[model samples]
Target: MIFDGKDLSHRALADRLPSDETHVFRECDLTEADLWGAPLAGARFESCVLDGADFRKADLDGAAFTGGGGMRIRFNDADLIDASFTDVDLSSAHFGGALLTDASFTGCRMIGAVLTGSRGTGFTLSRSNLTLANLGGCSLRGLTIEGVRFDDADLSGCDFTEATLSDCRLRGTRLLDTKFTQADLRGADLGEPDDAKLRAFAGAVITQAQAAAILAARGITVL
Candidate 1:
């Protein structure tokens, strides 16, 4: 049972679904719905309100959430490759080990979200607040993040190769073993990183003062 992108009510569409992905849901408001373990790949949810919806282990590859409002939604271990989320409220959301390659998140408010071990190859998160988020042991190459506040966030052993972080603030953020080879961090406020972290930020694009500070810690002053 699939509607051809036509307008349909939540009650009307739920009555026609086949308890699986065979029934396509287009542009419907599934707010607070129990959609756990649903195979809804290639489904287009335009401007849907999925606040507090449970999407644990859902196969949502190629899924599109445009102008969304899905706060506190669960996506644990969900396969979300090529998924695009615009204007989504993802506060306190958890995405552990989720395959998020090529995912685009624009104008999303992800305050205090937890995203550990999530693979983000070619991911884009513009204007998102990842403050206090746990992103340890994650790969984020070819990704672009802007206006992100990572205060007190755990970024240990996380890879940031060739990534762009504009206007990002890492105030007191944990960078114990983060890898940032060739990553651009211009205009970013990454206050006082440790020795191990300073080595990782050696080749990263940052202010000359930050580089000097890092080198100065090694007893090699640039006169």
Candidate 2:
């Protein structure tokens, strides 16, 4: 309940929030703050800036966004269930149509974050950067994307069933109509995928130099 230089709305910051513990918003700036439909469950936003903050339909269940850097933060249609974004930067953050079940983004940066049509399940993006992030049509089923970068990311029509993408980078990623059923792309760096983007790596579990860089970009000279 420390709103320095206050410009309160959200029912006057939920009547000076202190409904039995856990509401420490240190270094509070809350730029463009609206906090629409605010409840802010278990809130603790350390080093808080919250640039362009809206938090539409906000609940923020189990919220804890340490190391404030909430650039372009919106969280459209937000609930953010089980939220815990550590080392947060959240560059260009939006999270369109957000729910984010079991959210836990450690070491987060999230460059160019948008997350269109978002709906997460068992989320846990460790060592996250999310470069060029869009996550188009996201469902993100069975998520655990470790060491994530996702360079040039759009992830068109993302589903990622049975997901466990370790050491992820995915350069030049668009993967139109992306599903990756039974996904487990070990040590992933899936670039050079021609032949119509290798059919989105069906039943994804690529290795062997990403199948010789997707059959040498469809030249098919793999020995």
lDDT of each: 0.74, 0.78
Ten contiguous residues minimizing lDDT sum, candidate 2:
5-14
RMSD of each: 4.4, 12.2
lDDT of 2 by residue, 1-223 (tens): 5555443322335445555556667777777777776778778788777777887777888888888766788888788989899988999899887788888889889899997777756467888898898988777777777888888889888888878888888888887988888888867777767544578778777778778767777678878
Q: Each model's TM-score?
A: 0.77, 0.34
Q: Judging by TM-score against the true structure, name the best candidate.
A: 1
* Clashing residue pairs found in predicted model 1: 157-177
How does candidate 1 score on lDDT?
0.74
Clashes of each: 1, 0
TM-score of 1: 0.77
Indicate which candidate wins on lDDT: 2
How do the residues 1-223 of candidate 1 rate in per-residue lDDT, one tens digit apiece? 5554453323323234454554454555666676667767776676666676777777789887766666777888888999888777787788887888888778777777778867656467777777777878877775777877777788887888888888888877888778788899876887666665677686788878877876786787987
